[model samples]
Target: MPRAVAPRVRRAPAAAPARPAPPARSRRRLAPRFFRWAVTLTVWGLVAGFVALIFFAWDLPRPEDALAATRRPAITMVAANGALLSTSGDLYGETVRLRDLPPHVPAAFVAIEDRRFRDHMGLDVIGMIRAAVANVTAGRVVQGGSTLTQQLAKNLFLTPERSLRRKVQEALLALWLEARFTKDELLTIYLNRVYLGAGTFGIDAAARLYFGVPARRLTPGQAAVLAGLPKAPSRYNPRVNPSAAVDRAIEVLGAMVETGVLPAAAAMAEAERIHFPPAPSRDAGWFADWVRDGIGDHAPPTSDLLLRTTLDARLQAAVELRLEAMLASQGRAAGVSQGAVVAIEAASGAVRAMAGGRDYRRSPFNRATQARRQPGSAFKPFVFLAAIEAGVRPDDGVADGPINLGGWTPGNGNWRSRGEITVEDAFAHSVNTAAVRLMQRAGGARKVGAVAQRLGLPGPFPRDASIALGTAEVTLLDLVTAYAPFANGGRRVAPFGIAEMRAEGRPIAWLPPGPTPVITADAAEAMRRMMAATVARGTGRAAAVSGLAVAGKTGTTQDNRDAWFIGIAGGLVMGIWLGNDDATPMEGVAGGGLPARLFRDILETHRGRGA
Candidate 1:
């Protein structure tokens, strides 16, 4: 009883103080710790925002003139210097409206490449976040969640270099582009600029080159083939790798079905019937190369152009056929293995036919327009035309004897003199010594060079004694064009092939008529008559046409390294050359032999307008 009382008293005494029961202040202090944390976090956020502002303000690329050239849409017009080679790869890229695309094309692309395209505004936030997380987890960029708009933005204004700065720039440009253009407009620009396949730059070109059909005419199967090209055109080239391309196109067709772009049966049919015909592999590689060079000389290389050419399919085929036949017929006896043929309209600068070699696949020398080779007596026309202009006539007498040039002695091709002869006989016989004497009598080298220049020779024509021996190297194009004045009745119609050019249905440049008279009518007619005699009974006798009036000349360079037959018939000026690129001697070959025969065969075959 006593112990229980004592314990109760002691407990009551302790309870009396209660230790003041920890004050409310201590409990309240816990809130301050949380408040400090909140304040610290708030301060840090403000600091980060300020730094972001500074960076954004300082790191912007200034608006530049680099974009100035884009204000007016780039338009390119391509035309040939001679005949119509082709009118295929023409592009006047205006933004193609999404509505204009086969409808299913863009729909299929959206389904295959970007399903969330309709919901996004240039960027897919969820997709981006997911991709970023995945990249971080994988420690590499295994996924790219770029939307269609973003891809277009990068292609249009940014390079392929990868960096955080470029990524940021891409985002900025994408946002800006989205703000300025509608989905249709943006889609259209992308479609027009996107590379399709082959050497094509757009869906339109790819359609034509691969399918031999226009984009507007593309079927579902063909559309799928084109759609498959964006991933890797070269790797999945329908022309080079049809099986792979077909497999890839089937995937696109499947996407089309999934996206309701095509019915399932239609998609199946398209996938099953996915036929990709190989593109025509042109054997005229040299001709194509020459065409590129000619255009590049007058315009920049990157110029988006639709060139009109003067190439006649028929004439080109004829030239190629005749050349191959001639080379083959020569067997080993004709040691020459290279040749070129060029044909032009005498009244206009229209190039009708051009062949650079026997087979452009084997060689692309483009000897017709680019080769600088000795013309031999083929160049004598210019000298003779010049002499005629300087008061010498076809009937004018000149000594066909040994001629001496400044320490250089020139002899006839046969090393035999024809004594005194008419100017016509001198030209027809191609008497080198007499021609030298005539040049000396007709104001020497400078006058002959000037005459060649005036006649469109683009001469660096040699002004030495050997000039009469056709020592000056000249392009077949230049030589044929230089002879154009005589064929054109004394007017120099600068040789050209393109007829009319159009881009987006608008006329661009139409070739005007060429220069005025380079030689008097009398002189031209006299030279024409002389050259006609040459074809009729002289050196070019092998090139004579049965019914048509023809004028021509024959030439063979020193060591028989070159043989040339240049002439005009039925208003066409044609030049042909047979030679070796290595300057190897040709056996039993002369201008009047295989070259003249080939020329005559071509002329006879392709003489009429119907041809």
Candidate 2:
């Protein structure tokens, strides 16, 4: 206790000034200099990078050859005069030379898209400075500050990657563009490269695609619509986002008014008057898919391609409307269902009308071109055609009594047989047993298969007697094409879609006429006679065309899984199929019922429309 007391009393301290830990003044004094040094280093690094970028830009290649390398297939929409006849994007690229681009078009672009475009050396310093300040304050990259040349550079030489390296590449390409081309040339590249919506990539395509007019004829309002697209095409595309596009068009008009390109009152009036043109046929969805597949797979590689397809736009519209109405009548309570229809020009290979499915938005399988299902009784015509070709008279008698052949006794719908029926009567009543009997008598199944092959159907018909009962699978297109011979007096015609393809401004290729006959005129005539009898007094009676020479047959597969009506009236050969994708049987639907009714409605509508 004594030691602790002595320790507690003992400490005396020597004190100097309270320093405040050197007042933190040293660090404060050095920080500014250090920061300055850091800034200077950064500036120097940026300068060095800029110099390196300049070197890269100096050596960059020209835009013309690079663009040519892509050989982007020209815009290929099926159109008569820039009016889309269908909904799918089948266009290849079609470039118009810079000189061909309207002068006003470029002027409008410069006025709204860049404004100091001609004077700048691929960069606008003032605009850049403004963008920089704005971005700095906003804390994000907002304003692009891209000059026309920069835009051209990005479009021609760089991808849309968002990175420092991509920006560097874009800048380098822009400088290169400026060095290699004049302002006018760069402007042209920019005009051609810019994406104007509605599947249009250039001014020319946009003018033609959206307004159904040439760039030279674009009014101020249309020009504004084109100008407004570079911001965000999907948002401003008149075809895709019409309301937003109208708003953007108004904004563009305001910009035009401010720039003195358009009078204020004029801009306002035109903005109010601006209206989008009607879209191409909503029903040609199936046609477009068929066109795309036809070109991508079988079309020859060429600079310009013109595809002359067998599609009749008016007829297609009629088919679509009829199918839509039929579906509506069926109601949603019918559960999941789908349907397909196709029509061919009797004299030409042209497809008159086609319906791939009930709803393309829900499914793009295109049953007309892609689905392969049993033709059921629809296969009877081919068998009949083959029998006729094989010299079997339509009135020739075939016993319909049930016969056990190889343990498979195919019979009529009721598993019973109508004995000693003529071929014509048997086909008219859709007697399966009679068809099997005839098929067995006529070289088993090979005769039908041979006849199909001879008619230019895609290869390998099924090797079963049931094929005569339409048990073999076939695409609607193939079936239609094969039937075209009968309607066209036995001449086989290839089906096509594109009419012609052109380059920058010139035709590259024009589809010439298809090849000649595959079947004898005599055989085709006799077959037509037999098929005509089917519509006149057979299962295809519902599809009969009133006051028109119509020949056709109806098919119903097992369990009503597939129902089809293929027919020809005057110059049109149409095929309609009704079913589900999963092979589910439709409710009380038969080829002669719903499918035939839809066909008749479409035919009658087109007949009235005078197409």
Candidate 3:
């Protein structure tokens, strides 16, 4: 019994009753732990944000580098009449100051581009919110939130990319710019550096390019047009898309009314008065490109240049219109896809007008200067001229019948030869065999080549007898230049485009050397008479302009791959070439059919204007 009691007593003490924690104690314990967790989360969030900011700002461009950026040297081209023809490189007009601009000019841009420009510091939060709401409602992103300063920052120092990082950097750069520059100064830089369109890089250059006036002279309507360009430079370009530009300008005018910069009636008036000058003739672009390529030869390459060229704008327009009309009417039907034209002053050898193709946008290859093709019968003139130099008369008898020349027999265009004809008749009719005989009498192909070189045809002419039938390749420009001596009474003149090149208002001495005697005056007169006879009663009859002395040659290559008419009229030497770019045969097209008629039409259209 004692042993049992001792074992029972080993359960010694009874445990204390379990108790639940109070609500106040539980809350007090959780408060510190929750606070510590909150602190840790907040600190990590801040660190992440700082890392993101650094990631975006790491590659931000230096602000000072924006100011020191250099552009390619600008080339501004003007016609002989001082009218702007075209511009290449970075065409920035004279630096314009905001203070010098009309109040309405800046006001128009501010109203359309950034209504809150004066009220905010670059980052327009209200505008962003409003634009966001509007875009969300429209569902197609119909609104933009960028401030004018932000746009300037992106244009000056950033690539045009859309991403979160780019947006963040643009915002930072905008804020920095706003702090560093006054509002007016920022606007001045924007107006001076923002690209408008058509190779122009400023409001002033755009104004001159579009309206033929400076920025200071822009009307309200004109200013509205310029103000609309920043949205889409090429789309709203007044020169490229006038209707789109006008519609955009009308929107700008309406925005001006909304922003209280212009009254409703004034905006309506501006909409009604908005006018864009007719775009510059694309025909001039060919000549402009040629001058631009040769500009380095005349002026120092380091300076921006203004080239005053001898281009006759009126004649250029006429020639282009005629060529385009003719090609449009007949090119497709005849399988002709290309044409080129070159006109030069017969006395001074100045290129007055040039059209490399019917439509420059379709083909930019300068066919008149760059493409070298066989001149065909057009080369016969040089052969005949050589004969004249070697004591042959225009009336001298020559056999036009089929003849074999070193196993290569050449036949006339009609494939039927006139038995015995005067050398003038053989040349006028483009007789192939007679030209070969004349080449033989003129001491063969090499002798004729030397004569052509002296007369301005840059030639590494062939030595074969077939060279008499224009087997030699040459450019339309070279052929036209070689024909100039007859028009200018026998003086050799080198072809030139730039009359004067100026840098910083100082003229660079680039005058072409004076003309020299290349052929005897008597020989020149005889050739002129023979060429005139060819136009009057021979192969080039289609090239004649009524009551105007026109002399020219017709050239039709084998299979009609090329057709050409090189002529002189109104003291100008002009050349026309029609062909397919791949040298495919046309549909029975001959030089006498379309090319000669185009030459005649151009001459007639520009007859009385000193063309």
Specify the highest-lDDT model's number: 3
How does each model score on TM-score? 0.74, 0.81, 0.87
lDDT of 3 by residue, 51-154 (tens): 99899989988989977787787889899998888877888888898878887788889989998998899999999999999999998798899999999999
Native-referenced Cα lDDT, model 1:
0.75
lDDT of 3: 0.89
State candidate 3's TM-score. 0.87
Where model 2 places Cα greater than 4 Å from the true spot, the runs are 1-71, 79-104, 132-144, 164-182, 281-286, 295-308, 331-336, 389-392, 396-398, 414-419, 462-464, 498-523
For residues 452-557, write the lDDT of model 2, one tens digit per residue.
7777677567788877877667898788778888888888777666665444346655564675787788878777877888888877788776788878878778
Which segments of candidate 3 are over 4 A away from where they belong? 1-50, 300-302, 330-333, 399-409, 413-420, 504-506, 608-611
RMSD of every candidate to native, in Å, equals: 6.2, 10.6, 7.5
Q: Locate the minimum summed-lDDT window of 10 residues in model 1.
A: 71-80
Residue 268, model 2: lDDT of 88
Comparing 2 and 3 by lDDT, which wins? 3
